[model samples]
Target: MSKSYKKHPYLKESSQHTKYGKKFANRKVRKSEETLQHKDYKKQYCSWEISEYKFYMSEQEVINEFFASRNEEYHWMKKFKTLKEALTWWKKTYLRK
Candidate 1:
């Protein structure tokens, strides 16, 4: 009696000779790593306070509204030494509440 083994025609002896296979594997690994890194970055920066404000207006309109409101609310702050001081005053006066 002789021992017999089944042969698989689709199986390669070694992947070293398969250039296309190696490239495909490399691309798959790079894509998976990039996806994982992106997920981690998103998790680190996730915050509700950083969300967009709920307002329907064009960019110029929004900017105009901001400057108009700031001027009306904190006109005295314009005499401050720096814009930063003016902004701080504005925030404390209007946004803190």
Candidate 2:
């Protein structure tokens, strides 16, 4: 008697990804991992990079960058009660100009 075997769905010899899956993965995967809208918001409001080589940036990243760039010029930003307040002041004082 011969043994009968079944193939596993996930253990295929070749990839099971379809054309649509490949396309979606290629189109969506990015080094920065940020959406277009988020990038725009960060660039315009947070003074983030608007170039093609931009990376993902959080609020903390913004604060750190702010301190690094301004140095002693805007040291008062550290006195803000919240990150939002400091960011708002930074935008108004520097980015808006």
Candidate 3:
């Protein structure tokens, strides 16, 4: 019938997707990567633990006290790559008695 021509016609290809740079965001467009690799290798992966105290002490206060004066509450944290280093710092900072 007359409706057959409007439904499906014998036509050529509509369009072609000839593109490049598909994974642009996942790639790093940098000239030098030698120094970057060395820096990454020398980086320290430290794990920090923050403990909240009941009351703030004289010496054990937040460094930015003036910035947030209303919130007097503070917690101390230490970062160390290994358990031994973390225990050492904890003893020196907390268990000094």
What value of lDDT does candidate 1 attain over all alpha carbons? Answer: 0.43
Quick one: how many clashes does candidate 1 have?
A: 0
TM-score of each: 0.22, 0.24, 0.20
- Across 1-97, the per-residue lDDT of candidate 1 in tens digits comes to 6534223211122335445544554455556544555446444333332322232333344345455656575654346555456555444433333
**Each candidate structure's count of clashing pairs:** 0, 0, 0
In terms of lDDT, the poorest run of 10 residues in model 3 is: 45-54
Looking at model 2, residue 77 earns an lDDT score of 53
Clashing residue pairs found in predicted model 1: none
Candidate 2 residue lDDT tens string, 1-97: 6533332211112234334444433444443456656445334232221122223334476688656655565564557756677777644433432
In terms of TM-score, which candidate is stronger, 1 or 2? 2
Which lDDT values do the candidates have, in the order given? Answer: 0.43, 0.46, 0.33
| True-vs-predicted CA distance for residue 25, candidate 1, Å | 76
Segments of candidate 3 deviating more than 4 angstroms: 1-78
